[model samples]
Each structure stands twice: as structure tokens, then as C-alpha cells.
Target: MGRWEPNARGRLERAALDLYLERGFEQTTVAEIAGRAGLTERTFFRYFADKREVLFWGSAALQEHLVDAVAGAPDCLAPIDVIAGAVEVAGERMQERREGARRRQAVIVANAELRERELIKLANLSAALAGALRERGVDDPAASLAAEAGIAVFKIAFQRWIDDDDRDLTSLIRESFGDLKAVTAGT
Candidate 1:
């Protein structure tokens, strides 16, 4: 609540999400978000480049985590399996923040610009995954194909996760991967 609070970034994010939900993303401003958090506008700028960044600020870190997971996977695994394991680990991390993720998805769904930004973030993530696969000695089209498939698996599982309350994201991710494998195998 204080200007000097230790979790200024967290406080700002909470405040921004609250405002985005209450007033809509286009109607909210950085100053209002900062004020709601009992922080200064400068403090808000320090944590996020703009209000949209409040929703997308974690993209780079998530990408890096996935890349690291892929790179660290066992050499015996195929490219797709490596990606499967990486996305499952990512899903487990996301499963821990279900409520927050649900709310964030709601906000993104309400805004067209936010939706486009989300797609761009996903594309970047896919590219990063492909790069990681290539580094692991996967060939060009294979790396790209596996990366795109992995993103598709993540996207489908994520939507299912958002829509269903009974299933955990990790299971959804694994199930989606299995479905992909099944389709490719002509099952």
C-alpha cells in the first residue's frame, strides 16, 4: 500500500488487472493503475512498458524457460517428445496460477489488440522452440515442424484448460500431445 513497499511490481500488476477488468483495457491508463496500487506513474513505467505489458510481461521469461527445458531434455528423446516434456513442465507451472491465468485470459479475450499481441507472443515462443531444437541437431523443416506442433499442442491444451475446471493443464497438455501423435500416426 505504501509507495516504498517491497512488491511494487506485484502491487502494480494486481492494480492494473483490476482496472482492466473493471474499466476495460482501452479505458484504463497507467496513472490510474499506479494510483490504484498506491504507487506513482513512474513506478508503473519501471515495471511495464505500457498497460498491455502488464498482461504480457512474462513472455520472455516463459520463452526462456521452455527453451531451456527443450535444450536440457534427454538426447535419446525425439524432437517432438522433447517439446512435449518442455510444454508439460510449463503447464505444471501454469497450473499453480489457475485463477490468475483465467482472469488474464478473460481480459485478453475482451480486447482485439490484446488478442493480436497474444498471437505474436505465441509466434515468438514457437520460433524460440524451433531454435532450441535446431541447436539440439534437429534439421530445418523438422525443427520448425516440431516447434509449430508443440505450439499447437500448447494452444489447444491451454484453451481446454481455460474452458474446463475438472482437468489440470498438465494432463490437458499431455493429452493434446497424444492426440497430435495419434493424428500423425493415422490413428
Candidate 2:
């Protein structure tokens, strides 16, 4: 019975998404999602602060991994290179869950509220990346620019991953970074 029960977090996310897709985000209630997930409202609260948070379950971990990647990078690498490497490392982490990634992306794309939350999360992540770069002794304008550029690459790579059914996310990210570099060099 315990094994058959859905993972509490995943269940909440799936239930929230189903509700969002069916009734729209503005109309869905946390109690309804908890009930659908076979969890109590309190259990839903334990996992996520609100219904909207269910879609962002992995963001904090992704940010932490990016910070760790930047901190562990070799000292010889340039600031932009360090940020790029961190994004690449994060992409590797994402590669482990292709199906889940696609589903999450679809849920976000289908819901305006989810898309807004995703945008806010991306902005926060870019700030965190900039802070990490600064902690590594990178300077002002360069650190900010590099972090934003890295995030742009991540965005493009993620979209490409959804579009190119045959290609893996990690490879797409690496290619996106290359394309970003080429575009900048050409300008």
C-alpha cells in the first residue's frame, strides 16, 4: 500500500497540474489538489507553500547545484566560462529526467500563472548566478553580464531540447552556448 501510494511531492505536483490544465490556475484550490493526490491539505502545505509552488519543486535544488558548480570550478577559467560550466553541470543533472522535464514544461506552457512563476524563478536564478560569480572574485559589470548570458543560453537550450526530439538537453545547452558565443563575436 505504501509503495503504491504516489510520492507525496510528485503527487501534489501532478494533481496541481491536472487541476490547472482542467479548470485553470485561478480557479483551482489547494484543498482540491490535496484531495486529488490522496493527501491531506496539511500534507500539501508541508510540501509546498501554495498550489503555484508545486510547479517549482526542483528550482531551489537547481540553484544550489549551480552555485556548487561555480564554487568548484578551476581558478584558471574565465568568469563567463565559469558560469557556462555551471549551466552545463546543471543541464547534466536535468538529463536524468527527460519525461518529467517535458511534462513540467508542458504544464508551465499551458498555464499563464505557471509561466509567470517560471519567469520569476529564472530571474532569481540569474541573480544567484551573479552572486556566485562575485563570490569567486569576478568584477561588477562582467559578472552580471556573464550570469545573464549564461541564463539566456540555458533558456535557449531548454527550448531547443523541447523542439529537437532527437537531441539530449546537455548537448543542446553546449550547442546553445557555442551559438551565443558566435552571435556575440559576429556583432
Candidate 3:
């Protein structure tokens, strides 16, 4: 209850996720999360916009990483290849937060509002990805198509990674991309 909570942001995030998994996202409140973390309600607001934000606190940074990866890729690569590179980078980052990512995904799936938010977040990321591709001199449907396809592959790979923690996320993403290719090939 003291004013100096070391790692307050991390503590708040852990507290919020715990409360969310315990009481359901909609059933939980900022005050409850703050109290659980042994902090003030105001402290919760300082870290997140609301209880729902606790699940998405890292999304902005994720988006930045995705965009950076896309831009950082070699210019000679095709649009899809560039997208795959970005996806691989993002997948590797996800691996570092595997357990937390799994818990957060479960929480998102359990709440309709959170799920909607997640879709919106994905849409934003897709748009950002497309923009990043365009910046790389990619044109029109190619950029949009690659971005959309990348997101689809990412969704499947992320789900599979969460379903079983045995495999690295980057590998799962690669497998998911292969699955997409195979399915589209009608083979």
C-alpha cells in the first residue's frame, strides 16, 4: 500500500490479467484490479485506459515492431516475402511473451467486447502493414493482399502456438504460412 511500488506497471498488468481470468473481463473493474495489485484505483488509470485496455496494453508497441520489421526488410523481396519477414519478427517477439500472450488471448476470446476490440486492433495493424509496404514502393492490391494474408497466417499460427506451448512461435508462423499456401493451392 506504500507509494513506491517497484515495477508498478508490471504489477498492474499481472493483477489485471489475474482478475480478468478470475472474474471475466466485463465483471472486473479498474478499482478491483488496482486493489489486487495493492495500489490505488488512480494508479490503475495511470497505467491503462480501462479494464479492457489491460488486455491490449502492449498492442501499440507490437504494431511499431511490425511496421519496423516490414520497413527493415530488404527491398528486393517480393511483397509477400516482405510480409513474411515482418511476421517472423513479430512471431519471435510473441515467443518471448508466450505464456502472457496465451493468457491474454484466452481472455480476449472469452469476452465479446474484447474480441471485437481485438478484431479492430488487427484491422489497424493490417492497415499499418499495408502502409508500411506502400512505403517500401509496393503498389495497390499487392501490398493490401500480402498484409491481409499475413494477418490471416498470424492468427492461425498464434492460435496454434497458444493451443500447444511445445513449439516456437516463429516456427508455428512458418507452418501456418505453408498451410495457407497448401490450402490455396487446393492440394
Each prediction's whole-model lDDT (CA) = 0.93, 0.87, 0.88
**For residues 1-187, what per-residue lDDT tens digits would candidate 2 score against the true structure?**
2333458888888788788777877789999998999988888887798777777878999999999999999999999899889999999888877766777788789777678889999999999999999999998999999999999999999988877789988888888888999999996
Model 3, residue 89: distance off in Å is 0.7
Model 3 scores a C-alpha lDDT of 0.88
Candidate 3 has its poorest 10 consecutive residues by lDDT at 1-10
Indicate the TM-score of model 2.
0.89
TM-score of 1: 0.95
**Evaluation by TM-score, superior candidate among 1 and 2:** 1
Model 1 lDDT per residue over 1-187, tens place:
3256689999998898899999999999999999999989988887899999999988988998999999999999999999999999899889988888988999999999999999999999999999999999999999999999999999999999999999999999999999999899997
Residue 37 in candidate 1, Cα distance off native in Å: 1.1
Q: Which rank order by TM-score, best down to worst?
A: 1, 3, 2
